[model samples]
Target: MLSSKIIMTPKVKISYILNIIIVLVSFTFGFRYIFASAPLNYQLEAIGVHGWNDIIPEYRNMITTFVRVAGVGMTTASIGMSIVLFRAFRYGQNWARWGFAGIFLAHYIPLMCNMFFLKTTTESNPPMIPNLIAISIVLLSLFFSSNLKNCKAIENK
Candidate 1:
């Protein structure tokens, strides 16, 4: 019989925890956007901010639709990726470690850049710090983990 045991190193444990965080956060945001988009859009329009009225109605609707679709797609992808990462980590798949690392970085880098570089309003400011810190911790934990090193070695064999 094939052994289906997962070795739990400190790094692997940390990675698992971070993955869970990622899933939870993604799901939270995903559901929030999916359910609240209409109201949120209306609220933005009411505030007369974020150039809500500057754009033509047709273009505005297109943008809103795009954002909603993207939000749902991202949420689904994140959940699927979380499951895949969990299985990969359990089976000691080196590629999954790298994949997760890459995906995490890709997903958050733009947000971080926008948070720091672009001028954010009161509405946007609240989530910036918490999100940055959380993402930083996850990235650091994943990169610094010894599990990645072991996985790399395994990949070479």
Candidate 2:
């Protein structure tokens, strides 16, 4: 029988750790959106709409559905991105690096933009600190791991 355990190099290990952190952050916010009402209520309260569920139950449900959809998007996107990172990005695949960055930015940048728009238009401060941290981690991973000059050496091993 042949063994099939995989070993991680230092660079790959760093990428793996950072990718895990990104996924965890996404999961945390995703589950919160899906399971909790506090975050939605906070935004509602910010716009001077207290007891949103009591006042407009149907509207509340609609908004909650949107939030939950976003949560699902975040969780799903992170899982997909992690797969790419683990299988290809950490292996110095340039195409994987670009694909990950493009998909991640496409998914997250709009979210941040919506938060900013909400803050400016409705004075609602959505929780975006975690997202900013995740973006920073993503940038760090991409910037540090993007050097593919040694990819040939890695493949030769």
Candidate 3:
């Protein structure tokens, strides 16, 4: 009997490890927002009158509510995508590679823009440099690795 097992190349192994990193990073952000939102809000309030309080009272409330809701929503979505991508990539699904790359770009482009353009201080930018680097590695691994091509061929077989 012939074995049907797919051999994981080094690139595939690296991609898998990077995928796990992305999953951990996503869950960390989700839980951080879910648990620390109150303290975060307080810190934002303490920044100055030019911060959250500058807007009208009703608008400020609305904005705060929107932010909290969006944070939770993004957290859930990130986690969900992490799980889906993890499973798909384990089986060498080509779509998983593209999906992860697309999702990373979608989430981070605006985040990087905010970090670079909107935030004025290191304190305000959050500790996202490592996460950004991990994400970049995942993208590069997906795009340039021969393992992804092998995966695509396997999927088509």
Q: In TM-score terms, which candidate is top? A: 2
Model 2 residue 137 distance off true place after TM-score fit, in angstroms = 1.4
- Candidate 3: worst-modelled 10 consecutive residues by lDDT: 37-46
Residue-wise C-alpha lDDT for candidate 2, range 21-61, written one tens digit per residue: 77777778778777755447557856577666555777777
TM-score for each predicted model, relative to the true structure: 0.67, 0.78, 0.67
Segments in model 2 whose C-alpha atoms lie over 4 Å from true places: 1-12, 37-39, 148-157
Tens digit of per-residue lDDT, candidate 3, span 4-120: 224567777777777777767776766665554233543353343445546567766655565566467558657766865656656666677777777767776776665565356
Of candidates 2 and 1, the better by lDDT: 2
User: Candidate 1 residues 125-149, lDDT tens each?
Assistant: 3345766776777677567454653
Give the local distance difference test score of model 1: 0.62
Which residue pairs in model 1 clash with each other?
none
All candidates: CA RMSD (Å): 5.6, 4.0, 5.5
